[model samples]
Target: MTTPFRWDLVTPDRLGSMLDGALAPEVGYLTELCRCAGKVLARGGNGDLVFVGRSLDSMFDLLGGALEGTGHRLARLPLSFWRGYDYSRAHVLRAREILADLGITPASLARRARPVTFVDVVSSGSTFRSLFTLLHDWITEERETWPVIRRKLRFVGVTSESKTSPNTFRWQQHADWTLRLPAASVVNVSLDRPTWSYFADRQRKLTKSFGPRRWIDGPAEIDRDDKTRQALAEAVRLVELGRAREVRRMIARAMEGEPALAEAWLRTLRSRLS
Candidate 1:
């Protein structure tokens, strides 16, 4: 499995962000994003967060920065499960191997008490559905404790912010496979429209799409054009923002209203953040 070529910003391998000094960025969206991140963590019981694909890279970076020194977990899957691929047995095996590396195999799932929550920006929730199918089939084939493993799996979809109503289309409710998971295993966090489009459609990611076609290829090759460079700089800034004391406090405070706040685990974490 080929990994992406992302910079190790935490390690300070780069000299500068390469952004213009004179340009002042409007950052009203950050507060909302921190709230969303906090909700994602609280909803997942603050378990191991594994963001799926590039759409939520900003959130991943933000949380990664905030939780760097803490015991909280953060990771990115980078796997594009957009379907329509005729994956060979070898391809499937390789994909499973990658998942196993992340301690996501059936045995590990059953063994570990902590839930692994996969985060992603969703529209139709096709990516999440495809991922669930893959893991479910693998667990079935391996004859593992599906009952236990299912409980340790979770999904947080970042959907577009909208007016709340009874007719609002929720993907988890519409999906048949969600019935297999324990209640509340699949949840959602919403983002404003502009910010949602920024991540989902406009941002030029530093890594190439890790789709079925590129699994066996060499290290991820990404373009180094001006747009991508600008995006990279913005990403670096987001990471730094996440590391700020106020932002961490914001994250902690944002979890106050979540249902998980009643749990001792979350309260302990909130105390630590404060």
Candidate 2:
């Protein structure tokens, strides 16, 4: 079995600096993205909106905060579905069990009068396709109408913009393969290519290195690296304590280590928030 991924620990001061460097400049842009996503949720009707990955969990918190008083319901349905693996009977059973525990069921879905939107950070979009297939089959087994269910389904994908190409058509094509979701229904949020690429590489490495048990387990069953969590927690605590200036200084110092990333983050902030 492959070893689990782990994050290196850093001092609270270092973590604050790192987070400031990574996200402080992007706050306005990230907040705007959250607001826009919230608006999308609002327009999708009153059905439940489910976010599907840990990558989007923190962003979902921001989005939830932005949607305050918007009368939209949001839930996180974390699951990992990589390609090239046969989902065994036991795996399917466990998935069903997890969904049940999360109160996501055919009956509950049918009760919602509005469309359901599933949000995720999309690379090839295989995870969303696999998850949709699983849920569709489950609903079908319950003798639900496919047409009605199809009509009530929506997807929101966050993707990255290639620095060289700058065109999103390739990503759109990749996501459209096999899944027949309408062009309009698959909302995409584009991020800086290099930043996105760095994270994608890390995710691929982690996925490849994870043990079989982790591969089969529901997302909640897998643990996130404690160091990263601790760092983020401390950063949030500092922010809550109203130490904005200290945070800014720390971030500025950290940004000196990667001026390119700092510039890209700043550019994204200006372009999106302006």
Candidate 3:
């Protein structure tokens, strides 16, 4: 079998700087765009103004000041994300929640009888695409003036994809180095591969790369407990061997079902993946 997709790792300091640089500009970019786009939006002098996407309360607070200044109202779209999960439910709920909050009712939004501004706080733009796609399809079905509504909506914040064309909205990157998989890496992982092998390799590399940071504590400090250390080591192995399914099981077994260890195991996995 081919070797797994091992990341070209960097120190935590380097990672932090990269993340900061990538995400910092988005605040200004969104602020400018919202100011410019506010005029076109149907917010009756209150059509409907809502915030959709991840990190609701924080994004709300950031944009709330500007939105009120422009005579706009605000509603939040709550989202729930999972490890290795793609955007779907979050996208749908955001649109629905906004429509509901505006008193448009689900049937009206579904019917295209009302115009509303769709604002997305995007990190990678996947959720944005998903949201727009649903809106587009819903609008088309009603045989209404879809362009009018589409024109009123705006997407703000960070995206990860490059600008392949004018229509592309790039997700802002925070790290100096973009994580990329080597050309042959996917070949090493397969549905048939045993889970143990995956976990083993991940453990081996992560320990070597990240040093002994706490495995189960505040914002990820290196831990003093042998059990925490052992659990992290085992989790890395599962990931490496394409055994993600078993990593949680192994952690539970090792920690005798300790919640802290379980959380630490997940966070460590996220750090490695992130």
- TM-score for model 2? 0.61
Clashing residue pairs for model 2: none
Model 3 local distance difference test score: 0.33
Q: What lDDT score belongs to each candidate, Candidate 1 first?
A: 0.82, 0.51, 0.33
Residue 99 in model 3: shift from native, Å? 3.1
Each model's TM-score, in the order given? 0.92, 0.61, 0.33
Candidate 3's residue-wise lDDT over 40-97, tens digit each? 2211112354544322232233334323323335554432223244435544444444
Candidates 1 and 2 compared by TM-score, better number? 1
Stretches off by above 4 angstroms in model 2 are 1-47, 163-183, 194-212, 215-226, 234-274
Off by over 4 Å in 3: 1-49, 62-70, 80-98, 104-117, 159-274
Q: How far is candidate 1 from the true structure (C-alpha RMSD, Å)?
A: 2.2
Candidate 1 lDDT tens digits, 191-263: 8889899889987787888887676664466667666777777777888888899999999998987888889
Best by lDDT: 1
Worst 10-residue lDDT window, candidate 3: 183-192
| lDDT score, candidate 3, position 107 | 47
TM-score: the better of candidates 1 and 3: 1
Model 1 spans with C-alpha error above 4 angstroms: 12-28, 218-220
- lDDT of candidate 2 over 1-274, digit per residue (tens): 2223322221123443434333322242333333334333433333467877555544454434433334545666645666867787777666666677657777766665766777776787777777777787888889876666666777766677654555545455665433555555555555555545544454222112222255464222223354444435533443332223332233233223333333443333222222
Q: Which is superior by lDDT, 1 or 3? A: 1
